[model samples]
Target: MKMRIVPIGDQATLGDHRHYPGARLLLVCSLCGWDKAYRAERVIDRLRELKSGGHATRLEQVARRVAWNCPGCGRVKWRCHFAWPPGFDDREAKRLANLYRN
Candidate 1:
């Protein structure tokens, strides 16, 4: 699979998760060195519960809807990126899990 890096200013939507299965969103605070990883699906679900209509929400637009401030420093200097775990293959993992089993 080809890996694509979408610029922060690009219009990559939450729904793009379909194209990059198992990808996670990594948020890092430049001021305080705080960092965390969020599953794409959970983020989407949370946005839906908040009635934010996230499926069509662009990745660049999420900062406006979600709080990106660093909890430790109370600053909004954040760096966000889409990432996958080291040496983890999404396709192989899905195949082994048999997610469609009834």
Candidate 2:
């Protein structure tokens, strides 16, 4: 999978993803080259409530269980990455596996 670089200052508009109460999660779509900051807590809570799997805490773990369709291409096989704050490096972005994508 290729990592898409999320431009600086663009993370604020990704989505409702937030790591903490006020913090957000920066993510990138390796397939479509799309990137955004999503509201982590809200998405996680919703996923836990909607999906049959048990609760997941980590970003990658949560993504694995959640139903995420890429807004760029509407594909379900997309992966999400944690864009470490301060410096958004494509090499360091962690990949969330979509085991069910077919």
Candidate 3:
């Protein structure tokens, strides 16, 4: 199955994955050019383990709450987004990409 990248809105929470099935978290660091995609379920479980409110945590809040610091530069800059199952949409992807440009 093809996967499509989804723009994570400011109001999005970890639990929101239920509304968009097969979605994953995409974390990007602009400063160091570091990026990683994580499975949403795994992230939720990890958050629960850390006692950080798990699914209730908003995507925007994740950077502050999680250790998303760039490994290369050790900076705490991140652009959070989502990846979902479906065919890719170039237009939507481009728009989402632009939203994180600094």
Candidate 4:
């Protein structure tokens, strides 16, 4: 995989992603407090996904903003995610792996 440099939350970093081709994305939703992690290459990819497949209308508005209210929870804490360095401690790594299993 090519190491792509994308700007995220005012910080730029190299990451592995193909969906978003130019800039990195960090979404902090105010709806569900899910704090989703996304590596977006451009604003358009996020917008397009929300407009088409993701079914998240809330995400579309928060695309370039640092913080916004989430649609799910009616609170910002539950719905937003920001640019954070992805270093998985052992426990976190294990927890994430569990998501892939049945």
- The TM-score leader among the candidates is 3
Tell me the whole-model lDDT of each prediction, alpha carbons only: 0.66, 0.47, 0.72, 0.41
TM-score (C-alpha) between model 4 and the true structure: 0.28
TM-scores of all models?
Answer: 0.66, 0.41, 0.67, 0.28
- Record all residue pairs in model 2 with backbone atoms less than 3 Å apart, i.e. clashing: 14-37, 16-39, 17-38, 17-39, 17-40, 18-24, 18-39, 18-40
Q: How close is candidate 3 to the true structure, as a TM-score?
A: 0.67
Point out where model 3 deviates above 4 Å.
1-4, 85-102
Q: Candidates 1 and 2: which is better by TM-score?
A: 1
Residue-by-residue lDDT tens digits, candidate 4, 1-102: 222223333322222232233223455544444444555435446556556423233333444344555656765453222332444245653554565342
Write candidate 3's Cα lDDT for 56-96 as tens digits: 88887876665655788898878667776456566655665
The runs of at least 3 residues in candidate 4 whose Cα sits more than 4 Å from the true structure, single-residue gaps closed, are 1-24, 30-33, 46-82, 88-102
By lDDT, the best candidate is 3
Residue runs of model 1 more than 4 Å from their true location after superposition: 1-9, 30-33, 89-102
Give the local distance difference test score of model 4: 0.41
Candidate 1 residue 90 C-alpha distance from true site, Å: 7.7
lDDT of 1 by residue, 7-91 (tens): 4445677777666555677666767867677877888899899897677877766655556567889888775567665666757
